[model samples]
Structure formats: C-alpha cells, structure tokens
Target: MPENFAYPVGLRLQGRRVVVLGAGQVAQRRLPALIAAGADILLVSPSATPSVEAMADAGELRWERRRYRSGDFEGAWYALITTDDPEANAAASAEAEARRVWCVRSDDADAASAWTPATGRSEGVTVAVLTGQDPRRSAAVRDAVVEGLRDGSLAAPHRRSRTPGVALVGGGPGDPDLITVRGRRLLAEADVVIADRLGPRDLLDELPPHVEVIDAAKIPYGRFMAQEAINNALIEHARAGKAVVRLKGGDPFVFGRGMEEAQALAEAGIACTVVPGISSSISVPGAAGIPVTHRGVAHEFTVVSGHVAPEDPASLVDWSALARLRGTLVLLMAVEKIGRIAEALMAHGRDAGTPVAVVQEGTTAAQRRVDATLGTVAETVAAEGVRPPAVIVIGDVVAVGA
Candidate 1:
C-alpha cells in the first residue's frame, strides 16, 4: 500500500448500494455516516450490537444475519470490511477489489485500498480530514474545523432551498452547544428567526446576512403583546413563503408556551414542526452537579413551573400532593416567588430542612449555583440576587451528587 496516495472524493451514495462485512464497533461508527448520506446499506454479520440491530429493525438498513460471503459485494457501489477475522476482511477486500468497488478495512487499514477519513458536518458543508492514516490527527482537525463553522469563526455560507413553514426549535438550556442537531440545521436554513430571550443568543450572530433575526423580548409593547406578536409573526412570515423558526429556550412544551404558538400556526393553516430541546428543569440541576433522580435517594422526579406563586389563584399545581411525594422537585422560573413556594411546600408537609440547589443561567458561561435548604432557600436567593431564569431543585438528590 502507498503511504499517501489516497484520493479523497465525496461519494454521492444516496440511493446507491453499500455493503458492510461486520456489525461490530467499527461498523457501528461507520453506519451512521453512511445512513446520513442516504446509502442503502447491506450489513452482514451473525450478530450485532443493540444499536445496529435497532437500526435494522427500524428499516434503516438490511441485515443479513449471517457471515459475509465472497459475492456479497455484487451490487454494492462501496464496501466496508470490518470483520474481526483478518481472513474474512482480506476475502471481502479481495472480492471488492475484483468487483471494482472501493472497500475500507477496519481491522487492517494498511492492507485495504480505501480509507475512511475523519468527517464532520456543519450547516450544509461536510468536512473530511485525512492525515496520512493518522486517525487521531484527522479527527482533531475535523473537530476544530467543525467548531469554527459552528461558532461563526469560519465564514461559510450555506445556501439551502427554504421550505416555507414554521419550526418551533428548543435551543436547550442557555448553551449554544446544547441545542439539538436538527434544531441547528433548521436554524441554518431559516429565513426568519423569531428568537426568545432564553434561546442561545450567540447563535444569532452566526446566521447569514440575509436571515432576518427578531428579538422576541423587544417586540414592542409589553409581554402579552410580545407573545401575540410572535405568533402573528410566525404566521405572517410562513404565509409569505419563508422558512420561519421560533427558537425558544429549553423544551418548547415545558412552560415555553410553544404549544400555544404551534396551535396558532395550525389554526392559520400553516405547517408547524416542533423540535424538542433539552429542558432546563432537569438539565440545569444536572449541570449544577445535582441529579434530579438518584437510585435509593429519589425514585422519581417532578418538574413544575413556579412562574406563579402557589398561593396565586392562577396557579394550578397541587402543592400538597407535590409535598407528599418522597422524590425530587425541580422548579423553573421560581426565583421571584421562591419564598412563597417554599413556604407553601413546608406548610403542605415537605421537610423544612430539605436540600435545595438553585442554578442560574445554567449550561452557560454565566452559570452559577447556590445551595441552601428549604427553610433558607428564599432568603439565600434574595441575598444572592438569583434571577428569574433559574432552576430550583428541592429533594435528597440535591446532595446525592455532592
């Protein structure tokens, strides 16, 4: 085999046949990329990992459930020889070579004619790096390039055909990196982004110049008007044949009022897609080193919106029932009314000395955590100047991780 003679080219594998000689770790690592490229994969193996088996069961690929045979590469445009048996790999490679199909060998790359480069995708661009058989170097370089592309450090404009519709994307706990891949991809292709205050703000700077960025907080008038205007904006832009993204912080359905916006869009006869996000209710506490549910410590975890005090007529949460549960309690948007909420819990039979942790602006650089007890949490929050966009965790699990 030559030292550095591998010609790199992106294969248009969509609707093309590809064969894998194994279903082990190597195949597991390679299958996802092949699947993403829309390749029709034929996997041959006696057994496979649960993940691979799940993919096959889901009809994403064809599984042979047997050992690789010599003529397995008959109609394959590309082949991967990933069997643990060196003889089987060599046999599969030879067959692929005879059939003029490029094959990659995971067991022995030096003996194979083709090599799989470290690859990463950002926006619409796929970056593949090959450092003369050095997988570590290739992966590092690929990661750096992808990071640059994601953080706006690398300026690559992705021009995509905009599908006119509304997508409610959960940006995930205040961190740009925490957003789901689907949400990020939708954001890249968005023509108009109606973003909330809690959404990842740094992502707005990465959007293309032609993309319209609307700050939901500054939507004229007050909070009610802002929400109504956001709903109207989504309908108006999508109706005008532009791809509109309603980017919110945390899970759209978890107190984000995403359902209301979705309903409004549906009522206006607009197509709406909701991309679920990592909710702050759980993620914030986790980021602060507090598990919402711990074995033996907490059997269950309940997430509740504390935007309204328990004493308020508008509040619907059963404070007494929540207090009776021997589990974890995760409260969101409760900083302003923590005193009343804590008081209500204690009065309703919850322990006054229950461990409490408040995580503010979690999963972000400005993130901070303040620890207290049920009796002292409200005063501690006031003294610490904890803000509204914080998560309050009350239960034994708060100390389990500590």
Candidate 2:
C-alpha cells in the first residue's frame, strides 16, 4: 500500500515507440488515453477501424496494417494487444516480458504488465478504479464512483474528529478506479476500513501501508459472520476515536444493508455519515454505452433486484406494469432469471422483439456486451458467454451502438 501517491502523473512517451496490436474498437479505446499521455503510437493491424484510420491519417499514429512480426516490438517501451485472438495477445505479452518491455494484454488478466482502470479526468485529477483481480470490473465501479462525486452526493474526508460519523461508502459496481476523489482521499486518511466482499481490492493498494483493513463482507451459503456482529465491530472501532470506513460494492445504501448498520450506530450514540457510490442500476449499462433513458425511445427507467430471498415480497416486482411501461428496464443480478424475466415481460404484453443489451463488467477494460432482441437476448447471452454481476437493459434503446 502506498499513501498520497500522485496518480495521473504524465509519463513522458514523446519519443517512445509504443506498439498497439489491434485496430478494432477495443484498441481504439486505448489509443486516446495513451496518446493523451503522450505515447507515440505505432499501430499494427491488417485492417483498421474507422477510428484508428482517423488517428493514423491525423499523424497521431504510424500504421503498419499487417500481422505481427517477431520484430514488431523492437525498441518499444510498452505494447498493447486488443485483438480478439487470445493467442496473439498472449504471445505479445510473453514477448514483451522476455524483451523487458511492459505489456497490457487486452483479453487476459494474468498477462498484463499495467492494468487500465476505468478512469475519469477532471481539473488535472485522474480517478481510476482497479479490482486488483479484474481490471474490467474496476472500470465499471470507476464510472459509478466518479458519477457519485460529480453529482454532489459524496464529500471528501475532513479532519473533524469529535463527532466523526460513520460513512458506509459504495465503491461502485466493480471498477476500483471508480472510487470518488473524496472517497479516495477518505481512504488515504482512514484509520480503519471494513470492506465488503464485492468491493474492489485495488483500492486497498491506495491506502497507507500502515492502515488497518478488516474484511467484514458476507458470503452466501457459508459460515459467515452475522450482520449484527459486523455492525458492532464498526461502532466499536469508531468509538475508539478512529475514522472508520465501511466499504460496499455498489451504492452502499442500495441493497448493501447499510441502513441497518446506520441505525445500529445511531442507537449506540456514535457519529455516522454517508458517502454515496455509483449504483449498478444506471452506471453499469451506461458504461456499456447504453443509456437508460432516451428522449423518444424511453421516457423513464426502472431498476430492481433479482436476488432477494423468496420470502421477501418486495423482491417480486410488478412484471405486468413493467412490461406495459414505456421506459427502459434494467435488471441487476438477473442473469440467473433471464428466462423468467423474459417470460414475465412477454406474458404481460411487452413486445417479444424489444431490443436488449446484456453487459458484463460494464465500463471496464474487460467489458463485454451482447445485443439482441428481448426474444433472443437470453440465448444470445448464453451463446456469447456473458456471466454474472451483469446488467440487462431491455427496451427500444438497445438498438443504439457506440
């Protein structure tokens, strides 16, 4: 862990040869960031996407327009391969490592020299989210966390101590870079941190090496610590005159049982505060470039959980009304119930052919999305191999592509 490390610090790449092996949209996404950071790009691809061609024509990059060669990475400081071919990406990583040049493998996590966080730049401050495990997930959380700060919902940590209250912070969907500047600042100054199982671990690396972190997150179908015990631990730590942070995955207040912990702290006469983080309901799809609302396509958007207990009546959403509503429907943790959700919506009069987009690890470098009509979305997702912690956006607006 490192404290107060200045990030977004520009690395001088003015005269460096940086090879990018891919000309698809994924490769294009990395170009702007690298170029902005002053890397002289050498793009190697047999074919180029429109975006890549534009950059090459503008002299921002030198194009080879061919398959990779053994000497492709000669004298390169960094190499990035965003091709769909995992073998090529792996080969590039292996070669770069052997040459002692850093490489970022687009498709494999274990093969990257530098992981890209989902980042937002403002007024010279760059905020990035890292999962420490999944760079792509970090991207999603990063988007939501930045949104939380920009929307004026969270504040940076101050030196006040006497009445220091507990703030249950949400780190956003999955991106570690998504944590707020205020949140990151708070993390830097925190005396103790009690984090959730779903929160990104890369954020932990930003803390001072001396800071104490307690993993108090719950696990499903396991011998897990009770919530009451966790709440008690938070209060006890804060009462000892320490600035405590209870970190969650998405918006802490959403489904993280934050209110219960807040209530418990209040009952103990301990100071408490709240820092809102990004919620998957909106930011997840947005990261996948799917807007939840559009002028004529969707007038409203709704989000609901699909993981509540069977006995919880509130978990049962009004499918009939949702189907008839002229708006976007975003489902969190609904991958397991895709068939049921589609059936309910269709049975309740929603068009079977309504557009749908399933986004996994949205907004991160590893983001993957599958676009299909409602009638085919489930099958498409399965065929495309989309996984959990995903969002399903259903409506006419799914037809839009970035």
Candidate 3:
C-alpha cells in the first residue's frame, strides 16, 4: 500500500445514501456506477431528462423533482454536484463540507475534498487510475488499460483465495457487440470458460487457444447436464488457483441461475462477482425491429421465463393480469410451450389477433424472424421450426411495421 494513500479501500457504497444535485448526462453516466455499487440514490433535479425520469419511474432512483437545496446534503453520506450551474455546484460543495459529507464537483476539482477515481475490477482485483487532472479521462484510460491487460499478468498479484474465486458473467444475448466491455475483458483474462451451449459461440472463439474451454452448455429440457456438476467444476477450477468464468446467455441475475452459482460459491468460501449482460428477453425482440414499449401501443413490458418448473408456484403466471397490462409480453425459453402460453393468454382475454413475433438467433447474422397473430403464432412458430434460445414478443407494437 502506498504511504500517501489516505483512503486505501475504495468506498463500497452498497446501500449507502447518496444525493445527486443534477439529472443530466454527467449524473446519468455516474448513476450506473453508483447503482452497481449498491448505493440508494436520491436525485434532486427540478427538471429531469427522459432517461432520468424513466429511471425514477422504474424505481431505480428516488427523484425529488425539485431544485437542489442546502438541506439536500443533510444526511447524505456522499453527494455529487453535476449541474451546469457552477454557482449552484459551489453552494452544494459548501453545504456538503458543513455536513462533513464527502462530495465531488463535476466542474470544480479543486473544491472537491476527494475525487472519484477511474476504477475497474477483475476477480478480486481492482485497479484505480488517478490522473490528478481529470478523473473521467483517467477512467477512460483505465478501461483501455484493463482491455489491454485482459490476457497479461496483473501488475500486482492478487491475494490468493483459499477457496478460489469464480466469476459468473452474462455474455449478453447473441451479439458479440452487445457484451458489456467488462464481460469481454473478463473473458479474455479467464483461465477457464464454462459457457452455456446457447451462448454465442463466436465469443468463446475470441479466447486464446491456451485458455481452457469446457462446454457446460445446457438446453431447456430435451437433454442437458446437471447443474450440480457444473457448480462443482467451477469450484474445482477456482480452488486450483485458475480464474474460472461461468458465462451465461444473458444478464446472469436475470433468470440465468447466476444467483444459485454465486450462493454455492459463497457457501464454499469462494469469491465471485456478477457482470450484467443484455438479455435476449428484450434485446432479441428489439433486434427484430419490435419495440417492447411505445408511446401508446404498449406502456410496460414483462419478462417471464418459459422454463418454469411444472410444480413451481410461478408456473401459474397471472395470465389475466398479464392480458390487462397494456404492454408487451416477452417469453424466454417458452418456444416449447408456445401453444400452451398462447392458449392461456387467449383464455385470459388477450385479443386473438394480437400481433406476435418469434425472433431466433437474434442479434446474429443468422437471425430468423416469424410474424403472426396470437391465434396462429404457436402453429406458425412450430411450422417455422423456431427453436430454443428464441424470444416471443406479443403486442400491437409487433404489428407496427406489418
């Protein structure tokens, strides 16, 4: 540890209270980082842009919908001043200091007691780049450096985990381009990659030949490997001091069974991290030129798994409420149950003529799409031979271009 390093450990702001005085792009860029850090945010903006407003509506943030005031810093552990008004930022900075809370000024670094650093994390490894001039620039440089170091040895070795460390990453839908920058970097650095068969194979091909590749890929139901065996292999590889990546098709936490793996790792004393990815539940339909939500065609979108266990309570989705949602319904892994799902929706009051589209191999060069109404979608999809790893989108928006 460097002697000059006063705050050595980066602030783990998970569940911490943070207040942002602005609702602009600066705040937007920083919002994702804060949310990922687990911060409970309070955004104060007299006027919020569409994205910010959407986030507030989605419950990702608590919007005050008012001008920033000195009292906004009263109980905040940390505050960010991201407004274009320099004078307002200056006042917020002073208020933050009076409350003994740390604050960062978007335009005035000199007034900041401490500045945020450019940060990147790999299995138990965190690298913070400080340029002493611009943290944003430093962050960009850090991202590039992290990209370059994906396959190289770390500048410093990480503490050896006795139980080993594993990373469960979502490779995103099928587009190699849709994978998060972090997910791509981790893939390059991973010593071993255990990927689902449904995940994009092109991504796995990007790895160096020396990287061990194991095919743990599973299909919905016809035939697949046991989940327990997959978990054991991840543990075994990590305990061997090799970085293991359990890559999945979409956002690991979103119906990807990533939590189950993470829980197992924790019980075994192994360290793990989850990197979010674009899910086919939304991205696939989008690539096929279908908007999940529109001004009036649809106002909400519900993502449900088509792989629910027959005995599972969730298997009985509230189809009546779903039909009344005035939004789009997207089903993942539901191709096999297409007829049943459509029947349920129709029984619950959904219009038989509701437009539906099945997108297969979405986001890939070999993409296939089939458009039909709810009444005939099951038969249409079956005849079209659309397979697993496809998304079913049902709503009027699917007929927008029809």
Candidate 4:
C-alpha cells in the first residue's frame, strides 16, 4: 500500500475480539490502547515481554501462551501481527484478510491492510497522526499537536460548554516542568488560582494578568490563611461562574489537605477534579540520589509526617511499630521536629547508626542533600541550619541510593 492510499478511520473495539499474534515490543506498546478500548484481546504467542505478561497477569487480556495456528482469528474484529517469523506473519495476515478483519503488520507496512498512527491525547481530544511509514515523523507531529492543545497554544474554539468548578491540582515537587499537563492546562484556563507556599512556585509567574492569583500563604507553622477561609474562597469564586484552581505542592491527597476542599465542594453541590502530583515523599528522595526501596536492601518504604512531635497527644503515628520495621522511612514536614522524631525512633528500637539523608527543596536548583545517621541527624540538621520543606530519608536504602 502507498502512503497516499492509506485511509484513516477510528475503530470501536468495545466488546469486540482483537487478536494479537506476537507479544514483543510492538505488541506491548499497542496492547494498552486496545485494552483501554474494552477489547476482548486474544494474545497468541509463545512468550511475552515482562510488561505484557504483567498485563495478562492483571487480567487485562487472555494470553494463549502458544504459537499462532490456523483459525486463530476465528472471531477477531481486528488483528495485530508482529511475529518475527515471516511465514507466520504471512499466514496470520492471510487469515485476517480471509476473515475480513482489519490487520496491522509490524514487519511490513506495504503488505499490511492497515497502518497504525502515532496517537496522543490532551483533555478529551485524541490526536492521531499518520505520515505513511514514517513513524518518527508521525510521533513528532502528534507530540507537537498534543502539547499545543495542552498549553492552549492551539486552543479549540468555544464549541464545547464551559464547566465552572474547583480543580485541586498537585503542583509536583517544586519544578514547573514536573507539573502534569492537565494541571498546567487547568492553570491556563483558570479564572482564579489559589496557590500554596510550597510546590511549584515558579508556575505562578506564568499566569495571565486577568487570572486572580491568591496567595494562600500556607507557610508551615507560620501565619497563614485558615482552612475554612480557603474553602470559602474557592466556593465564593466558583459559585460566581469562575473557573477555580486550588494548586498545592506535591500530591493534593498526600498531606496537602486536598480532600477537605473536595468535600467542601461536594457539600456545596460543586464538582471537583483532583489532579495528583508527584509526592515529595518519594520524588524528593529519588531526586537526591536516594531510592526509597532497593532490591534486597529494602523491600518496603514508609512515608510519615513529622509536623508534630511523637510525644504529643495530637500525634497518632505508631513510632514503636515504625521503628521495628527494617525498611526505608520517608519523613515529610519533619525538619522542625526531626530531633524529637529521631530520638523517638532510636528509643523505639531503630538503630542509632541507621543511614539518613535529608533532602532540602528537592528537584529545584536550590536543592541540597545532608547526610547523617539516626543518632546524629538532629545535630547535623541543627548545625547545618536546615529548614522546612525538606524530606528526611532513614534506613539502609539511604546508603544504597547514595
């Protein structure tokens, strides 16, 4: 088939059988979309890549675990043939043609009855680009179009109904680029944005002059806007037909009090969209060359809030249980109370000499790492003048990541 002769069309595969002849890279890459389309996929291959096998184990598709045979496409509405063997590919292609099923052949595009396009999505729009057999070109085009759509550079005309609601978006661990595309898009479309002191502070500068940028001023343990005041503000603006965006640092659900805002919206009969951000609990340690979990060294990791001292009645953390576990412990908002927390951990059976790394302002240009142990972390932090918005990693995985 020539490039000019290929006709593009969308296939609805819901409740339909789609046959995949191989489980290699091509199949692994294409299976997710098929599964998401609600296809009853039949993957016929001797083996599969680890990711494809995981999808099968998760019951996303049925794996035959055998070589393709005649009539494999007995009831298939579509076939994706990617076997390395030319003979098998030809046979499957023949079967698909005879069955009148649409087929995409990875080995040879000229011989294939159909071609796969480079696909991408932004919001509710799906962008599919096809430039003959030039997949890289198609992918590049798709990326450009999707990025434009996400950033509102190629804004769609006002054809769809405008939805006014509160969006609780996690700004990701202090990097403007780390914020999700949806989160960025929401910011672009926001009529009003209520921002936090932490998270990605640089993105606020990008908002247009018309967009009201409210400083929530939620400095940890400092003078700040009350939670009720913040909730009332979100409601007041949204009720007046304004598109409100509540932007916070890290994950909105991860100690960001996002759910509280969501619940308030629900009570007021306002819709809310929660966009999850990369939590600093995991990302901060990772950005600081510390793997929260390392194979054999640490199998599990725990993230704890150290905002309050363990000895405080308001604290609910099981310090003894956490100390007993031989795994990585990630502490957020704990810089102020780290001394007491360290003492509690050591007193509750955690090793005094356990490796610890305190990552300050992770993923930003100002990011820095301080290394010590459970026994000396407090003294090291005090001596170094470490501040809030730092992640404290404790356990042997700290050494492994280092």
Candidate 5:
C-alpha cells in the first residue's frame, strides 16, 4: 500500500458473512462495530477475552474455538486478521485475498486490503474519519465531530415519524453532558417534552421550535403539577399521536416517581419506555471529590430520600437501623429537614462528630460543597445558603478524600 492511496468506503455488511481471526484486544475493539452493522460474524480463536466470551455466550456471534484454518474465509465477504502471530495473520490474509474477500490486518496496515476508520453514529448518520494510517488522529477527529453532534453544535436534521408513546428519560445529575446517548437521541425525536425542574434545561432550549415543551414544574396546579395531571398529560399527548418524553433528573427509579407514570401508561394501554440516568446520589459526591464507598474506609453506602422527618408517621425509613450501620449515608431532598434528620441519627447511636458534606447543584457550574459535622450540618447548610437539589454524604468516607 502507498501513502494515502487506500479508498474509503462503507460496507453494507448486513446479513453478509464476516470472518474475525483472533479474539484479542483488537478483535474486541472491532467486534462491536461489526455487530452494530448487523454482520453475520464468525469469530475464530482458541481463547477469548471475557467480553468476547460473554458476547459468544449471549449468542451475539458464532464462536469457533480453534485456530484459524487455511480456508476460513471460504464464504466470507470480509475478514479481520487481528492475531498477534505474524505468520498466522499472513495466512488468514492470504486466504481472504484468495477468496476475493476484503481483509483488514491489525499487525500491518501496509499488508491489509482495507482499513477500518474511526467511526461514530448520530441521528442515523455514521461518521467515519480516516487520517491515512494515523489511528490517533482519526480517533481524535471522530470524537470531536461526535461531541459536536451530541451537544447540538453540529445539526444533522433527521426526519422521524412521531410515535405515540411515553418515554421516561433521566437527564442525569445536572450537567447536560452527563445524559446518556440514548436519552439525547430520544429527545431529538420527541414531539413533546414534559420536563421537570431538575433536568438539563439547556437541552430543552435546544429543541426545535415546533417541538412542544411543557414545564412539569409550573403546570398550572401550583409550583408542581399533581401526579394525576402529569399522568393525564402523558396519556393525553400519546393518544393525540405524539411522542411524549417525560424527562426527569437522575435515575427514574431513584426517588423520581417514575414508576407511577409508567403504571399509568400501562393501564391506559399506551407504550412507554424508561431510560436510566446517572443518579446524583453517587455522582454528586464524586464530582465533589467524595467517594461514597472507599476501600477499608466505608465498605457500604446507602442512598435515602429525606423528604420527611424520621419521626413523622408517614416516613418509612428506619432511622435507628440506619444509625447502627457502619456505612456511608447519602441523603437527597433533605435540605429543609436536615436538622431533624441529623438529630434523629445522632440520637439513635450515630456519632455526633461524624463528617458530613453537602454538595449543591452538583456536576454543574454552580456546584458548591459545604462540609460540617453531623451535629452542625443544619447550621452549616443554613449559613451557606445551600438550596435544594443537593446531596448530603455522611460517614468517614466524607473525610477520606479531604
């Protein structure tokens, strides 16, 4: 192969035979893309990495537990030679060439008949970048383009038929960047987005003008709409033949009241899907340099909603049992009632001097951390003017990274 002479093209491998000779790191890296392309993959190797083995166990591809043979590429349209043995790679490449099958060699690019580009997919468009033989340059450029597409900096207008359904998408902690790729893609396809106060607002702003945006926080009933009304809205919009995305903050199951809406959709016979997000309970403390569970420091961690005081009859949490555990405690939605919660914990045998850290608006530009003892956290929170949507971590792990 000469410098910059290889022609770049996308192969439609769907239902086509593709041979992979080797289950090493290189094969592991390339197998996913081949699978995504719907290739009829035949993987040949004596042994494989755990991930590759898992794929085989899951029936994602056919695994032949043996060395590559001379006629392995007999009926293959494409082949990948990733074996570390140069002789083996050469043998596989020779077989592929004899069979008129395009082959990619990981050990030697000059010997390969094809080159796999650094690829990314966004809004049904696959972006593949090739910088001659420079893999590093290709990967860097691919990442930049994908980031632009994800952040709405690069617009690729896709015409999607609006499906009548409700999707509960978790927008992640606070940063728009933290949202999952699937969540973002669903947002792009949504006809109506019912968003809560805590989700990534910047993403909502990026939606097209024709996309109806409903503020779940200000939905007429009061500061927040009644749960029944929210359910009604989801069912109503879906019945109107619109794709409704119920966007919330953090993991939908993590104190987000997502199951209620899911049940409502199920009862109303409307289709619904849930996309999990990075919960603030763990991520917020991590952003503030606090580990909920540290080796030899805290072996366990518990996340609890502290909306109601421990002494309240409606509260289901067992404060006494929580105090007895030698683990880290992460509290959410407890800013208003921190005093009673802290006092209840201490009264139930937890150390008064236990370290506590309150992280406000975590994973965002407005993030702030206030550290105090369990006995003084309430006063510290007040003096610091810490608001809601904060995560409070209690235990020795809070001071491990201090």
Candidate 6:
C-alpha cells in the first residue's frame, strides 16, 4: 500500500458502541463494514435508503428513526457524523470532541479527528492504505496490493508449510482475467497445474518458474490425454503431498466433465475443491451484443451440447421438443455438427428464417460474430471460416437488443 503520515491503525470495535448520525449514501456504504466488525451501531436518522432501512429492519443496527439529538455520542467509542444538515453534523462532532471520543466527519474531513483508510483483507492479512488527501489513490493502491497477494505475485519465496490437495478450477471463457479470485489464489499456491487447451491459456504464463504445467488438452478430432491418465496424474501428485490444480475452460461442470475428476479424487481419498466459472452459454451471447432472453422476445432459453448429431443414437437432446419452444437456443461444442443440428431444428417446427448469431472465441481478442438464420447459419459459418469454441444463439432475442 502507498505510504502516508496518517499513522494507520485498526480499532477493535467488537461489542463496542459506535454512533452514526446519518443513514444516507455514506452511511449506507460504511455501515456494512462496521457491522462486519461486530460494532454496536446506533443510527440516528429520520429516514434512510431502502437498503439501509432493510439493514435496520433485520436488526443489524439500533436505529433511533429520528433526527440527531444532543448527547447521542455519550456512550460511543467512535462516531460517524454524516447528516445532511451542517448544523447537526457540527453539533455531533462538537459533542464527540467534548467527550474525547474519536470521530469521522464525512461533510468536513479536515475537521474530523480520524480518517478512514482504504482497507482490504486477503489470506489472513489486513492491508490498509492511507493517503490523507487522495482517497481514490489509497483505494487503488490497496486493491493492487491485495490482488498481487492473492495472485501470488507478492507471495514469499518459501513457506513453512504447504497445503496438499487438488483444486478443479473453471478458468472462465478463455480470458485470463475472468478467472475467480479464489481460483487464481489457488493457482498461485499450486506446485503443479494440469491445464486444458480450451481453458484460460494466458493464465499459465503467470505461474511461477518452479510450478509444473502439464498439457491435458482434449482437442476435438485431434491429440488428447486419456481420462484415466489424467485422473491417475492428479491422484499421483496429490499422494506425493503436492498442491495440484486442474484448470478447465468455462464452467467445470457445464460439459467440462468436472464431476468425473471429483469422483476420481474421492475414490483416491484426496481432497478436492471445485470452483465454478462463467459458462459461455449466456456470457458469450452478451459479449456479442445479444441477450438470450429479452422481454417479450424470448421468455426462456435452453442450452444443449451438439457434439453428437441429432440422428446419432448417443444423442439425448429432443430436437422436436426444442423446435416447438418459442424462445432461445444456445448450443455449445456444436460447430462440428451445426449443419445437422440446424437441419433437425428446421425440419421439426422451428422457422427456417429464425435469426441466428455465432460468436467464436467469445470474450477473447480473436472474438468474431457471424450472423445468419437457422436456414443458412451452417453455410454462413462455413463460408466465414468459423471454427470450434463458438457459441451458437438462435432466436428472435438475437436481434432484440443487438
């Protein structure tokens, strides 16, 4: 965090009285932290925003539900004066001064006896940055430090102990930044990472030099790693007391075969944590300026895997039923069989001219959208040289908010 002369220190306010003079935006913003700190909050405001009122209704704070009164800070260890009326704010600050209680004046920071530092916590560590003058800069610095710590960029080179287990992390739609904070933190602590070709490939570049990365790519109609081999690798490393991360693309459970890995870990008696990611089913369409379900345009949406052709005996999807729905359809892993899928949809009951939009490599630098209809989407995709890792959107909602 950035340096300052504010002499930052954290106050232990658990079960202690803390007075707040207003319940407007500032109070609404600051009250939650106080409540989380286990402070006994006394809110003196005639009215509050719906959010603040709900907090009061839930008994999170003691709300007087009236204008500020003299001696409101009599039993308070800390006071926050934020009323709309300058006179009320000044009076509360003066009372707090006479009582020798520390106070923060939101209306006039210069007159306040205390300043609130931008604060954040990660991995059992509390970080506070105080810039007395630039609250925005303080917040930015605090965020940077916390992010670095969580991503292991600032982690110590050696640790007294290491956590041995396996984590199934959903890397999220090919964007490194889209990975969850918890997932990133786990990756930073990992000794080995088993990654997929379709996962957030960029994140692999950020791993430390000592971290081992294994390509567990399951390329379509190409080179791949057998499921048994991948499972064995995970169990083997974990049994050797190494921290392992199985990084997959999109949601681990959304056709990513995450449960299979989890079950494998369970049978091996290895601890496994599964972290979900943003699936392309909805996010991909939104990235390409399409809403899967727009009011009146689409009342519902269905997601299906098109890896198997409609005529294939292994296919479980009911093409006829899907065609009868007057909503949206999202297909994943269907680029290889889009022609057959489109034919089945049109042959059943769906309109041949239904609007369609295919987003390739959604949420990445190479993302591109190809527009067509159910009647010609296959041809359009082929003519445009579209490839796998694309999201297919079919419905009137495709054009509702385009």
Per-residue alpha-carbon lDDT of model 4 for 1-402, expressed as tens digits?
Answer: 654567779999999999999999999999999999999999999999999999999999999999989999998899999999999999999888999999999999988899999999887789999998889999999999999889765766457668889999999999899999889989888999999999588898887789998888642323535887788888989999989999999999999999899998999999899999999999989898888988899989999999989999999999999999999999999999999999999999998999999999999999999999999999999999998889999999888855
Off by over 4 Å in 6: 1-4, 156-160, 218-225
Instruction: Report the lDDT tens digits of candidate 2 across residue range 233-280.
Output: 888888888888888888888878989999999999988778788887
Ranking by TM-score: 6, 5, 4, 1, 3, 2
Off by over 4 Å in 4: 1-5, 12-105, 111-113, 151-153, 218-225
Report the lDDT tens digits of candidate 6 across residue range 297-383: 889999999999999999999999999999999999999899999999999989999999999999999999999999999899999
The regions of model 2 sitting more than 4 angstroms off are 1-164, 218-225, 308-314
- Rank order (by lDDT, best first): 5, 4, 6, 1, 3, 2
**Higher-lDDT candidate among 3 and 6?**
6
Tell me the lDDT of candidate 3. Answer: 0.82
Clashes of 5: 0
When 5 and 6 are scored with TM-score, the better candidate is 6
Model 6 lowest lDDT segment of ten: 217-226
Ten contiguous residues minimizing lDDT sum, candidate 3 = 151-160
Candidates 3 and 4 compared: the better one by lDDT is: 4
- Clashes found in each candidate (C-alpha, N, C closer than 3 A): 0, 16, 2, 0, 0, 0
Off by over 4 Å in 1: 1-24, 27-80, 83-103, 107-111, 117-132, 137-160, 208-210, 222-224
- Look at candidate 4 and tell me the lDDT of residue 332: 95
Ten residues in sequence with the least summed lDDT for candidate 2: 2-11
Once fitted onto the true fold, the runs of candidate 3 whose alpha carbons sit more than 4 angstroms away are: 1-163, 218-225, 308-314
Better of 4 and 6 by TM-score: 6
Worst 10 residues of 4 by lDDT: 216-225
- lDDT score, candidate 2, position 75: 93
In order of appearance, the predictions have TM-scores of 0.78, 0.57, 0.62, 0.80, 0.83, 0.92
Report residue 389 deviation for candidate 3 (angstroms): 1.7
Give one digit per residue, the lDDT tens place, for model 5 in 1-402: 767777778899999999999998999999999998899999999999999999999888999999988888988999999988888998888888788899999999988889999999875678899887899999999998987776555666556664589999999999998999889878887899999999999899888889999998666665545988899889999999998899999989999999999999999999999999999999999999999999999999999999999989999999999999999999999999999999999999999999999999999999999999999999999999999989999999999889
**Candidate 3 per-residue C-alpha lDDT over 1-402 given as tens digits, one digit per residue, 9 for 90 to 100:** 742243635788888899998998888878888887889999998887788888889899899977877688877898988888888888889989999998988798778866778888655567788777666688898887665665343333335543347888888888877887777777777789999876667888778888999888542323435777788888888988888888888888888888889998899888998888898888888889888888868788999877763334777677668877778899888888888888878888899999899998899998989989999998999788888778999988898766
